[model samples]
Target chain A: MGAHTMEPASSSWVTLLGDSDRRGGTTAARNTAPKELLWKVTLGDSIRSSPVLAAGVVLVTCRDGHLYAFDARTGRERWSYATPASVHSTPSLSGDLVLFGCDDGAVYAVDRTSGGLRWKAQSEGAIWTSPSVHRGTAYFGTHGGVFNAVDILSGRTQWSRRFDGRIHSSAYATDDRVYFGCSDGCVYALASSTGADAWRYQTGEGVTASPAVKDGLVLVGSEDHVFYALDAGSGAVRWRFQTGLGLASSPAVTAGKVFFGGKDGHVYALAVADGREIWKSPSIRQITAAPLAGASLVCVQGFFGTTQAYDLNTGDTLWTASLGGSLGSTPVITDDTVYLATYPGVIYALR
Target chain B: MNRRTFVYNAALGTLHVGLLGTQLRAFQNTPSAPTLQIDIQAPDLPLSKLAMPGLFPGRVVQASHAGSLLNGRVQQAPVGQMLDQGMRALTGESTSKEAWAKFIEPSDIVALKVNPSGTPTTTTSIPLMREVIRALNAVGVPNRNIIVFDRNSNQMEVLGYHNLLPVGVRVVGLDGDWAIGGRTRPGYDPNVFAEMNCFGERETRSYMGSVVSEASKIINLPCLKEHNASGVTGCLKNLAYGCFNNVARTHRFPKTYTDPAIAVLCTAPPLRAKAVLHIMDGIRAVYHGGPFAWNPDFVWEAKTLLIGTDPVAVDRIELEMVEQKRRDVGAPSLWDRNPQNLGSAADMDRSAQKNRFYREPGHIKTASELGLGRWELEQIELRKLQIS
Candidate 1:
């Protein structure tokens, strides 16, 4: 088996959007929201992939068909890899390699240190989900509903299974199971070893949000306007919270609170145990990206207009940044820095 | 003018249109639709000769080939045969190229409004999409002049339409942000729109998709799916709902203005004038819960294709096919307004069969009365082909 790193980096926030738990959108390493503007840089085009910080380098993909690596401190260009088509898959780190999916229908593994091509595994359709690295394997679902598990080091297919609906949800991997939501309106948990279906829980509309797993529950939001927490083993509904509209954004679980944004333009903080609303913010612009739950603050990247930071406990607005272009990428954060990418290809580092 | 006189003028057409200039874009008829109350208005724009019921009116062609789909994959040669046979039958032209040339020109910018809402299950067939692009190319329309589009860009990408299409063919998504009302919604023309008052909510105007305004002609690619709110979604709903922004407001739970609203939106001059063809993909038909793949149990391999210049006639047939399939499966009719079926369960991501709203399948007949096409069987001709 190829050696891949599953150990967490000391302080770097490496979530494509969320922490390893996924539905928990990066509240692990960061307990504070950065408030200072440290640096910003414009890339070739707009970004859809969230920035992942690893080894003092920020890795992000662009709509211009390029995967770029920048110095975490100065936002300086470190190295870059180019793909044939635009990339929506955020760079996921596994061992010495940085893996991401591309619109060219390939899962690319590039050298993390030099951005050199290690191997590229082609799939049947374009992959929009981030490669979920688990136990020396990279898992992802494609736009065509083809799910593949590739060897992390060799970039060879381990096994593949096709579902009935398209898959936009990135996979959430545990030791024994991998979970993902599908446009077929179902949350699916597959046996990690064999890539076989373990259980499936149906939702009303399509589920594009990636699943977040913690405490034996798989949590995800569906386009049907419901946030569901399902039993990990059997896929039974543990609880569900209804929102005004559907959810394209995933959730962040931290300190027993689940923070999420809704397509209906509201930010919600709920108790993780029973899906009870702790606090719901007033309506704002629509949000399609997951929120970052910190120790005292929760930050949300809006689909347009502004990115706001709210009091984690009270849902009170703390700060708002009205960036010129639209914000779509889910921002990553550290203890004192927030690295966000926006439309028209601009990246901002808040410290 | 009184309502009676207005009705008289509406029947008289363009003559009364100029005289009653203020009400020129007025409601075509006062439909006593039980569930929905709607008033539609548009600017009095000039109608093109190739509008709505273009070239041949009241004619529909159904092409069914059992071989079109082989083991879950759409077979290329068989689908090509289906398109060829359906087009030839619809136009009465010996050659497929000649049939396509009836409406499309080498200079025209053709917009293909494809439904990607229900991917993998009921979305436009990739084979059919490719075939349409090939047919357009054969008609001397270059790939650059072709635009394939849907309502949501995200869904389009998720469905892989952009990657599948030819390089030069433009793929666009008409503005999103259904609930966020503001100038935030781009990709829609502000000037050309259909204004209506349906559920007493604000923002009564629905704008035309910006791509529709730029294109000279549109070839509709609607899937055969039973819509929860509008009954069966075919041509009229495809063009009307697909081309307009903020249209989901027409259906809100217990009721919807989908009937008259759909027909009235079809009468909008800019949209109605440019829609020259309708091709319904029935390869995988969703008979019960749909527009979304709400339930895969309701999906059946219909192996059928429909073609027409008359939306109302084609949709009527599409409606019948969906209803019959529902009946065969012991499912409630799309037109089933039985009070017992309605449920107030907070609409969540639960795909239950509880009839939520009174289904408004009469949109087809309302569209016919709006002069889009023929609705009655006696007024139309259907040519069916069985291809081996």
Candidate 2:
């Protein structure tokens, strides 16, 4: 049986803060030039998870165990909820509820308006991956090595599938299919509704990068040191990119190119058509942060607390900023500003 | 069908979906339970010091004596005899009391820096620490004079040291005082290790220079273990823990030579000379999948004790024992990493091979490069004795 799929829960549109509707569609008015520095927010610890933007609130999870809500424009903290463990998974916003996994071993649903707890379902191990929400069900992976689909309001599980290793990536759902990878060297496409397996692709080693779905293709990186593309429908091999080192970052797909950082120290832009390297940058030592896709820029976070912007057209280095320590958090860009947090507790709103 | 039957059918359909989710959630939340292997061994008898290697290239100082116990039995000798052995190995006829005074005085507050990086379930062995406390008291050191410490309080609590601290001794974890007002300068830093050390340059800007400098003497208590990233986690690893701002840079890349970062960490400011003595806890050892192992069964119960005033002698003994134990266990040596270990052994041999200078421990050799201690191991005398 294939991995199950769930019908869309709410057909009613939920208007969020973005110029485009949710799912990160690009707006025509985005500025392509280098932006200025906006305001900066200092956190108590490093921000390791990506920030999710929705419902006028930018949700960020910090290593200090707090899920912070900030005004997307002003960077003022709206409300913060403390978890029993670190919040390594970026929160998923579904309507008025924010769904995310915490290292505390629980999946939490908090009210979007008040930051109030709705319901929490406990997992066996720490939840380090961001959650993917569809219909009324939320799908996510856990350190316990399970991919789960949970009901939003009732905190009940729709279905779950087990793997031989831990899941470090958020499950990406498209139509009725859910795609995710495990550290056990496999990428799985499951039917979201019934929790049955659809198809699986074996990588050279354990897959730690989150699977990205674009144009019927599922792209992911593996510890075996390669980035792979597979047919979303049949789980057949589409193409593969052999990196000098293991691909630790999730593939960010845009404009027919897949950008990812390899452990061997280089950030490469690969042709999605054949997994051919279009252009590769010098090794950045360790590029683990998944690059953020934008209209004109590819934003990447790297070691020694550096954040850099590159021209999407030429892969030219545009500008760089110092974060003081490591930049583990992925950048979330707005129409006028790019917001990111560093491991040393500093949050920057670059305009 | 009747109207009631139709309503009941619709409700049942909704509940079926709910049931499917409940079952899935249960499966997702359930983790494979850890297989617990618990073994308790009676403390080994008649503890004796290991042989110290002779001179090498580095600046290594020899310890006049070796292991000495405190309040507990060593199975080797009485407290007085152990004191005599340690005294003969050291420079003076100073009693264990005088040695205590010289190492730490009543007014001098001492920091017993303990390496808690191994498994949280295991520690440096309670009986061994109790013996060190006994020795301190024998030397006229007060109960409150010594503070046992690590970087994280939660781990210390997991190891059951928090409740044990108030009993006339101080036990502190570096994270205990994480708040703004509670934080002390040069002690705890959250921002030190944000970058990679690939080019092998400086990685940190500010460090905890205060907490370490405030202590009169820092006694290093480390575990004997195998490290995949660094060759060994010994006294140098113990001292480097305080010197570096971040440790994640080493493991962020798999093939990166983390040993250089460790070597540089020992040579850094504040923590190098602060290491006054080296005591290796070899009771419960992890010869595989360490410095932290989830499977506790890998731990071997070896009732052995190693002590020396010279960090080099202490470390050299540990490196050899680690290699010897790996061989005894029928495992490949750490040098098999080939390229990663490319210059690791040669760099170590330069400081530890007993030839031109006194052979030293790797950390002692690195610290000696930073001018911390003598690197010669032969100058160390094995004042081995029975502590029963």
Candidate 3:
């Protein structure tokens, strides 16, 4: 694990919403839009998990209970692994293994190079959130509100803690603390080592959106139509911006700008400093997925089957594409390509 | 125009001009004096012989204050004062302390059953709930002994009741977090249930929550709204469905209305004996598309609270208020069976017309048949109060 951690940082997108920091690989020098469409592939079922690129291969999980690997450049199918139930969780890469949870109540670790199963661990309830690999441990939560920490190499549980509500949001981890939201209307920060409670901030409603931690604040949204910015160390509310409807879209913070979408059919951009609205683009219909910030662009998927890209700084419409099917999955952007999937099983790769 | 002619013209879609003229005339006239007493005596049974013995003897108090709401939000001070007046008027006590003491005791484990359904616009007001809690505290019930509960924890959290209530007051949800394939804890008492089959639903038995079983007494807090299945979700439906699980099966299809199901559930032993008071929040009433206030246009300011020990009697009066509001809004009667009034699948697909259910407003009368309380308006003793 230490040897792998010492490896030079590659420009690979290998996890749900891009890495444990959840910045979607945002960087100042890499901020430029992709040029045009590269390729497209049609699959068997809807894809709710965003595609993850690692080792020249793209890994995606579909509602048909199959995990597929395709060549990142040529769009050629490499292999596919079948599971017992549907997969809604995106794959997170830890060394040579790809980890993800399934609705069948099991977490699977497959070989990243070949789509072969390494080991599987059963959970008490449906595992809907994607797993985050930190150090040698894989952390995930279940619909039964139980958060589990497991050894990534052996597929053995290390420890688990149960809360009072469902855990629909994925866990975001730093070196010391882990942050996640629960259906019980609380955002909890726990010790990454022992899963002990660090602190918890109560919100006005259930929080299905995952938290994005940057600087000294943790940002998340709730079903009560409020977006909260909390002090990361003490769990104190710094500021809040209320929308017309509840927000299920996890926020993407890049260049001090926060981008998310609301069920009220609006996409919003806000300043991270004071939670003030920078600009809002309305009339997009419901957006249930997280926004992706990369390549100087902010992209959001609408539940009504459209994906819109806006300029990261100006909130202007960069481009729009109608996939002709409902979309609830976040898009993945590489150095020169954008990969998105529709609920009707179509994956589009645009450059 | 007279009432009969007006209703007939409304059904024919020709009452717009007449309704506007009537509204103008009503606005021109001085407000009528409040009626001190409305005597409604049931011929079959005497007031002393009722299902809930010694509970108002079929009497209910309707207390209203125009100042109850300001800027669409409940005024906390006015709500507290309004509750005090309503409690005194309902129990005929001279002081609020004396009135609250009549039903609550220091040793009692009092549970406040709240309805948190519907849109955020029309749930039980937090101000009203805080006032209820204050009254309970005034009567000597400890904060720890008072429990505020609903069926769905997700909905309860959305309302932030835990943060809104005083410290030590416990909030519980019967269904836990995720309802689908979620494990049922001891929160529900499997020993007690309301058994019935509606449309061959597999989960025929509705289990009662353990909170209701353990409570010494319950204060039912329900909102005023039009229900898609039971016509009006008032005191009876709130207790009947809110306290039990697997109740969604009671009204699956339009034809299988929640008539006897609601009455049966309310009359179950776990709920019938423990629930002692009914407080209906009418500050923001939904005349249609309710039980879920999805549309804001259907909501109106009622600025009133109905308090009583007799659930049936209170609901009977509540039904009238909702029907009257519907009439004022030019919507058809709750009992209308016309295809246009009942709505079709296409209409249900639309947002504005989704409230059109083959409504079972007769559930109130069905509960009356089960000896719950008085259903007929004529058999109720209503005392109307205008709070300053």
DockQ of each: 0.05, 0.01, 0.07
State the lDDT of candidate 3 residue by residue for A1-351, as single tens digits: 222234323336667666677775543223445557788888876676678776677888986788899887888899999996667788888888988999767899998777899999888556768898887888888775689889998999988899876677888888888899887779999999999999999886568788889888999988767899999999999999988777777888877878888866678888999988888886575676788887578888876678887877777888877774333477777556777877777888877
Candidate-wise lDDT, in order: 0.76, 0.57, 0.74
Model 1 TM-score, 2 decimals: 0.57
Model 2 DockQ reads 0.01
* Best prediction by DockQ: 3
All candidates' TM-scores?
Answer: 0.57, 0.53, 0.59
Candidate 3 chain B lowest-lDDT run of ten: B34-43
True contacts kept of each: 0.00, 0.00, 0.00
Q: Give Cα distance to truth, residue A340, candidate 2, Å.
A: 1.4
lDDT, residue A160, candidate 1:
93
By DockQ, the better pick of 2 and 3 is 3
Give the residue spans of candidate 1 off by over 4 A: A1-47, A54-351, B1-45, B176-185, B344-353
Model 1 C-alpha lDDT per residue in residues B1-388, reported as the tens digit of each score: 1111112222222212122235544444444422232333444556777898887788999999999866565666899999998999888889999999998999998999999887544788767987999999998998767888877776565454653454456667664321111222347776676655666779977777877766789999999888878888889988889888789998877777676677867877767888999999999988766777545666789999999999998998898888787678676777776777777543311433555688888878877776889999888898999998
Rank candidates, lDDT, best first. Answer: 1, 3, 2
List runs of model 3 lying over 4 Å from the truth.
Answer: A1-252, A259-267, A273-351, B1-54, B65-75, B162-164, B177-187, B344-356, B384-388
